[model samples]
Target: MSTSAQGPTSDESLTPVRWGVLGASNFALTVSLPGMKRGPLTQLAALASRDIGKARDAARSLGIPKAYGSYDELLDDPEIDAVYNPLPNHLHVTWTARAARAGKHVLCEKPIALSAKDAEALVDVQRETGKLIAEAFMIRNHPQWQQARDWVRGGQIGDLVSVQAAFSYFNRDATNIRNKKEVGGGALYDIGCYAVNTSRFLFGREPVRAIALVERDPEFGTDRVTSGLVDYGGAHLTFTCSTQAVAYQRVNALGTRGRLEIEIPFNAPADRPCKVFLDDGSTLNCSSARVTSFPTVDQYHLQSEAFSRAIRTGSPVENSIEVAVDNMRVIDALFRSVESGRWERL
Candidate 1:
């Protein structure tokens, strides 16, 4: 496996982290493999799918060295240093544990598990296996989000009071894993996790309580539309996510004296530079806005680099299992709030 051109390609002594992907899912094939290939620390090593032909085709497309007809085969390979688990939400914890027990570091996609309780099991898995396991929240590593947080902490937005975000996309296909109720399909789990995760990121604390209104799809039996308010006691984070609406995403942090906005918060494009706006409370229409644009970056590439670096150095992963479990607690509370019709205390 050769190093990619995106990072410090001049470092000849650095041994690349051998990575194996759990499944040949679309996100893994298109987004993850290509993105990781762009980073020098990663070596596109092995890919696995239930079908050998599909796995081989995917491997050939991305130039990954090995293809396995079963996930266990790739996990059993000693050369693979880490595993990227882009499996469905329900399978996240199961496969993540398997990879860890196989003595491989794992990066599992979010929402990390079906429930907070289910996600908590990985805490024991990591400690017992002595292997690092992390949740894949690529946005946390993005420059735009980091800058936004830095500005907030620096008082650029004085006394951050509230965060507002919305993420939605129309997908009602019953066959899609995202719409399948049995497999943990819903707005809250799919897209709303970003809203919940980002709000907590800016707040620098877990929400104290949560209240929500969730509307389920009649046919899919999944939460199609969910609006939740997470109270951090003094500050609040509010967001709405929908699986049956037009595709859109935006995040704004409003402080006592000013506001900051992320134009394309979630799903920021890799080809173009992204922008964030800062405004004094002099106007509401963003007329008094000061704009800052970030250079072109693939957050996924940065994410892969960070994960592999952690594995190589024996350091902590960026989003540890503990962090993922805390996020899950917030999501669980919001769901409880939907049922109780009252604020659920976290």
Candidate 2:
């Protein structure tokens, strides 16, 4: 596919950044697409899929005005200012590179690549293209995570001690993409990424070492369950994630003087208030813990707006490719630990 640059428009400052969806993934349809439509600085311009019929149907159903039979066609559309890539893990790097070279900013799905080396390649592409490219980490855009980070940094949690988190869901469908080995399928690449990313985000530092244990499904050749520990020198993080278990998630940060607990940490509710519980360690009773509730907000919308504003104003994107590379390094170390049955230094 030939790459082309998008020309500047006279109304660029006044018009919203037109966005195209690279695929009709469920998450794209249910979350990102709706969020882009609601974003103040973004417009849902087009939808694309390998199948023209599917793209047209999705576009009509979602109220988007245009549809393309292939991702390359969508990338070539000069009217589109950016693209949201909800493609599978393996395709993230390739399509993002294509979109960047085509002069389109990219907001790609999480675990931007299967390995740190692969993530670094995307970082190089971002630098060479000089385009706004970021990993779609919506939690960082949520007020709840920002508040939690503030509390931790402001000494409300005192000297950081440890972080514990768990994310799980039951999905035994062998035919699902998540169950396929060649496409970067596994609990670690899927929901486990949140746990890893959150640990780094809250700690504000990379881990020095990591150890992990993973259990693979014999038929699927993908990890069904995984547990890992990351040693961050002064503090450590422990987390467990499973794809074949009941749906649930929670994150807790413990310090010498206090503790912070996040309910529904990873998959936060957009329609209702989400809460963070804090215990100052001064009290011996559970009732002394302070509860803070955040108003209902769509994090995906916030993410889209932030990206669009960055593209328009030349501001910094929140989840940059560099940060994604760091997260992937930890994930790579964890996988190495799993294979060697020993601690892997990052």
Per candidate, the number of residue pairs that clash is 0, 0
Error of 2 at 257 (Å): 0.6
Model 2 lDDT vs. the true structure?
0.88
Expressed as tens digits, the lDDT of each residue in 127-166 for candidate 2 is 9999888999999988888888888989898988899999
> Model 1: per-residue lDDT, tens digit, 1-346?
1111222222335678999998889888888678888888888799999999999999999999899999999999999999999999989999999999999999899988988999999999999999988999999888788888888889988999999999999998889999998999999999999998898888888889999999999999999999999999899998999999999999999998889899999888888888888889687677788888777788888888888887777666668899999999999999999989999998
- Per-candidate local distance difference test: 0.89, 0.88
Task: Give candidate 1 regions above 4 Å deviation.
Answer: 1-13
CA displacement after TM-score superposition, residue 253 of candidate 2 (Å): 0.3
10 residues in a row with least lDDT, candidate 2: 1-10
TM-score of 1: 0.96
